[model samples]
Target chain A: MRIITAEQISAAVAELCIRANRELPEDIVSAMNRAAADEPWPVAKNTLEVLCRNIAAAEEMELPVCQDTGMACVFVRLGQDVHIEGDFRAAVDEGVRRGYELGYLRKSVVADPLRRINTGDNTPAVITLELVPGEKLELTVLPKGFGSENMSRLAMLKPADGVEGVKRFVVDAVRKAASNPCPPVVVGVGIGGTFDKAAALAKHALLRPIDCPNQDEFYARLEEDMLREINSLGIGPQGFGGHTTALGVNIETMPTHVAGLPVAVNISCHVTRRASMEL
Target chain B: MEYRLKTPVNREELNRLRAGDMVYLSGEVYTARDAAHKRMTECLDRGELLPFEIRDSAIYYVGPTPEPPGRVIGSAGPTTSGRMDAYSPRLLDLGQKLMIGKGLRSREVIDAMVRNGAVYLAAMGGAGALMSACIKSARVICWEDLGCEAVRLLEVEDMPLTVAIDSLGGNIYESGPAAYLESLKGGK
Candidate 1:
């Protein structure tokens, strides 16, 4: 068995939070570059160019690409052979609190939705733990901003709705989102499973490298078709109008009940940030 | 069209602006977003003076990160303007002239802009680091407990913005896409 101390876990997570905010993943950065180069509309092209500058400036300034440093979403892949000392959740929260403070990232989390008071420290990260077979413990800190998150949608379609219905729902959601989600956006579509699981699958799908297609040929084709359709909407970069409304489309699916055809669309801005480490 | 605009931009200057035009704004701009907007509106409702003057002011819809050592401000970028729609029309009627943010405005907010001779500008969203470069200085005005959401006064030099909505009711969110779609149809 591999033993990981909470102090170690907390320290790693803190660095991840700082890293995720200050630096964007290379995959996301390249996707934006490709979109900018390929955009047709003049306004859209200019918008993409400016966005690239932002990315570059962020690296130089050691600041977050966006001011909405977002809620600390921690994803942990824990191995069955691993034993963690101390309270695991508390360790994660401590990391977020210190990371936001040390990194000068915004503490955007609120203690209660209705109460609307700032939590002071960006504590109590949204944690997702999955148990796997290996002895290595992997942690990914996804800083998800609300601009794109608020634009996401879900549908519980009838079995008859099928693929076409899913496509329509996804396109309509993007159309409705328009300039709000900060195009060129990254879309994650979750099909199958129950309602909540489908939503989780959609978000999880975003962690997949944008350049890598789903291993399944069928899902890969669906992603391409949806990307084409979404770009056809002329929403472009920043929705100022162009051919690159979405940088990529990713779909995740799993087996579901006979009655269920659940779908969730998780939209991410160009600044989609996640940093991972293994302990 | 591109223009160099300095606040407090008056009704005449706003009328010259049109949707889709790029502008570089330089002057003292006030910052506030969801939380601070709520607080400001509540203060007005109680017949209390706001912490800063609103008339002819350019209010930025942003919640910036904490500044690092020696820097005047942290990464400061616009938040969604839609969230403040409910409170904006009242501020517009109070003679607030310019609003800097990203995203579509409510129809009611647009109508108020047209009525009040105001304009909406879109600062490049997610360009916080770059945006902060334009801001020379920042100081909290009120609601410090709100942290990032506290209202601040920022002195910016040549802050780039797109005229998303002009005083005459032109809206880039509507026109930009429709024009692109029309050209696509025209091509075929």
Candidate 2:
């Protein structure tokens, strides 16, 4: 069995925290460039220009692109054949504490939601673990902001509602969100799973590149259709009115119960902050 | 569609502005959403002094992120105005001039805007960093205990904002999107 040291995890997390804040992933940057090419609204096109420029400037200056650096959300895939040298959660938290402090990321996470006091370190990151068959551990870091995260929605539609219901839910979500999720948004649609499972899948869908196609042809088509319907709302970038309402729609689906057709829409802003590592 | 404001705002005069618009911002407005509105109306019942003089002054519903170093502020973006619906009408009774923010305003806030000759301006949401650049300075006038929620006196210059709801009851969030969609459909 391969043994992964705690020090290595800590170092990787520290590096990812700074890198993710300063760098816009190349895939996301390329996708924004493509969106700018197709965008028809002058104001939205201008906004996309600013977004692209911000991405470039952020990299050049080693500064965060957006002020709300977001809460650290780490996805870990641990291998059954590998052993962690020490306490995994503590090691992960320590890494996050160090990253937020050193990276100058916002300490947005409050100890209590109602009282609304900051935790100071942004520690105890939203960590999710999955056991896999391989010997290597895979980790993905997503710094998720509240504005777009607050806009996420889940629905448990009847089996009779069918694809039409799914499409309607997505369209309605985009319409209601209008200008709020920072237009030229990316809509991650998760279909066909239980409640929590659908939400998780929706978030997982965002990890994919904006321009990439879902392997399932039918689902890929659904994504395209939703993209068209959403942009047709004319919410445009920053909701000032234009053709660039959403950059893309990504759908991820799995098998579900005979009675339920669960759908979740996880919205992400143009910033699209995330990173991945393997150890 | 062009309606003159009782409290006129000349375009040239508005050109030289900053991130936080401070023009003695008059010309009819409504109030809506969240924590501030709730307390404003509660104070109205007791006839207490509001944090700022609400008469002829616009109230923007926003919750911004904490500022970073060598920077004036963080993601100072607008929140949904609908959440403030329950508390808006009371302030409008005192002649609140304008309500600024994003999302759909509640029917009550809209009614107050129309009745009180108020306007609702839509500031770009999620354009916080861009918006912050326009703010010259921000000082807490009241509610210091609210932290980021304090009533801040923001000095702004030439802040770009669209008139979403004018005194004439022109609803942009509703009509703007529909109009653009129609033009697109008609192949304009």
By TM-score, the best candidate is 1
Candidate 2 per-residue C-alpha lDDT over A1-279 given as tens digits, one digit per residue, 9 for 90 to 100? 999988889878877876887787777788788878888766567767766766776565445666557788888999999999998998888888888777766666777879765576887788889999989998888888766887889999999999999999988988888766767788888998799999988988888887797998988888899898887788877676778888788899999999899999999888787888999
Clashing pairs in 1: none
Write down the C-alpha DockQ for each prediction.
0.86, 0.27
- What CAPRI-style quality would you assign to candidate 2? acceptable
- Residue B43 deviation, candidate 1, in Å? 1.1
- lDDT of model 2, residue A151: 84
**Local accuracy of candidate 1 as per-residue lDDT tens digits, A55-160:** 9999899999999999998999999999999999989999999999999999999999999889999987999999999899999999999999999999999899
- Computed on alpha carbons, the lDDT of every model, listed in order, comes to 0.93, 0.72
Error of 1 at B172 (Å): 0.6
Best candidate (score: lDDT)? 1
How would you class the docking of model 1?
Answer: high
Error of 2 at B24 (Å): 14
Candidate 1 chain A, run of 10 with poorest lDDT: A235-244
